[model samples]
Target: MVAPGTLLLLGPLLAALPGLGQGQGQGQGRQRRPPPTQSPLEKVAAQEELSLPQLAGKWFLVGMASHCSYLAEHSHQLEATAVTVTVLDGQSLAISTFRKLDGMCWEIRQRYLPAQAHGRFLLKGRGYGSKVDVVVGETDHSSYAILYYQKGRSISVKLYGRTIRVSDAVVDKFEQRVSAVGLSEDMTYYFPTYGFCDSADEFHILDETKP
Candidate 1:
């Protein structure tokens, strides 16, 4: 079962959409602000080595356990969630996320910078309340992989593969990493494997470029 409250991770960003910001509408005034945030998610240590070439290109987002209502307009069976990481220069990667936000398909781009570790990096993007540290799990750079992101009050764990469907052993590895990060069983949500990412009209890319 999907934990409905996982949408909090996607909160402020989506709320910044038109007519969606905190208290910026007509007739809705004097509203109190949200309380200070202390997230349970802590950054995971980065690995010693990362292959930029092997990590490049598009990868299917098979699963996620986070506080993000990215698919609010559709069900788990509607479409697919995915991303493309283009290796820029030598150390950085251009990450483009394709997901549903505020009732529409959105493509958000952000530059990922190398942090204090080889496998860890800071997300150089706006809209997020703070720096998002992305940690990569075990990978051969060819098949299945796992990604963990933590920042502010958000914890995002994602499973990716060369294709939409993966082996049970692959999913098992992902589940292990999810637990390693302190995500309980109730926080997991597996996006259905509908193979809808290839649908032309189902997704339209938008450039939310950060300056």
Candidate 2:
């Protein structure tokens, strides 16, 4: 069986949920909070003139922040994930993610089609049945990168590092971005630093190629 964290690697399915501002312990008598004037996507901006070559190679999934109810509930079950990037024709991106589920390593391959924006891309298929908007919001192309994923109104932020551990300064920057998107610190989760699956057998690979 595919683990919940595996599904998380592909994309978090969007579902109807309360606003981020609304927290627990608020009763019916408590005043309802007003929603943010700006949507999560609006708060994020992609990097311009993204250098695909510099971004190619292996990177570990270090941290992630999302308001997805499922993720919030299963945060403890997070897995060590790593992604490898390959620049396709200097325009598109070929991504392969490695993670373990049920004692077996699995590899998921997907292509990110370039958008009109230099650092933005669109992901289609993979059983989600809808296009997911992906933006390379921030990355040094060497040490660490912060990416944003959006499907419909749901948005999530991820921090990736070339190594298993990143500096505290990088983590602070990631948290700031997460807050800018209206998500709180409580919604953030750090992935394991060790035991990253570097490869998967042919039978465990799920290749979602696009033409």
Candidate 3:
């Protein structure tokens, strides 16, 4: 079962419609105000071999959550037309995405360094108009951390890996990590259109392998 607070976030996703439109606009207006810029994960991705081509191909959206209701609502509408990751240097990465929502394409160029374990990838970039940190998990054949965004009292999760769905055991372990972070359980939801790991037609593979 999803937590009450999480349910509020998931309500928009399940409905398949944008939610809190006016509220979101107001929030963005407030975000325009200059805030402190320092990221905890900046050092992590830089120290490690955070390669972009290594992240190429299709990635499944396992789950995502954000405190901002507007961002949460927009998340449901997020569909990637194409994702391109390039290793700018030993300590930086350039990520470009063609999204279907606004038909507006954008790219994020980030520099990072290593932080502590837990496979954290710290990053600093200018794309969304602020300093952001992206914490990534250790990479393996099936799973890896995509990125993490943290600002003041809010934090958003972005997990990108080979498949969207995991085995029951893996899901259980991931949930434990999420709970420890004080993130509400129900706040997380998968992108079903992308398909899961066990499915015959995984969106990441199909979309990437296509000519």
- Which candidate wins on TM-score? 2
Residue-level lDDT of model 3, residues 1-211, one tens digit each, is 5666896987577555543332345345322335756544342242155444565545555556555677566656755333345544443444544333344333322344443543344554434435455665434434544456666446666555465455666556556545545566666655554412222222322221112
Give one digit per residue, the lDDT tens place, for model 1 in 145-208. 7877877556778888888888999889888888877776667777756533332232566544
Question: Of models 1 and 3, which has the larger lDDT?
Answer: 1
lDDT of 2 by residue, 97-192 (tens): 999898899999999989868898988856654778889999999999999988877889999999999999999999999998888999999999
Return the top candidate by lDDT. 2
What is the C-alpha RMSD, rounded to one decimal, of candidate 1? 12.8
TM-score of model 1 relative to the true fold? 0.67
lDDT: worst 10-residue window of model 2: 12-21
Clashes of each: 3, 0, 12
Return the TM-score for candidate 3, rounded to 2 decimals. Answer: 0.51
Candidate order (lDDT): 2, 1, 3
In model 3, the worst 10-residue window by lDDT is 202-211
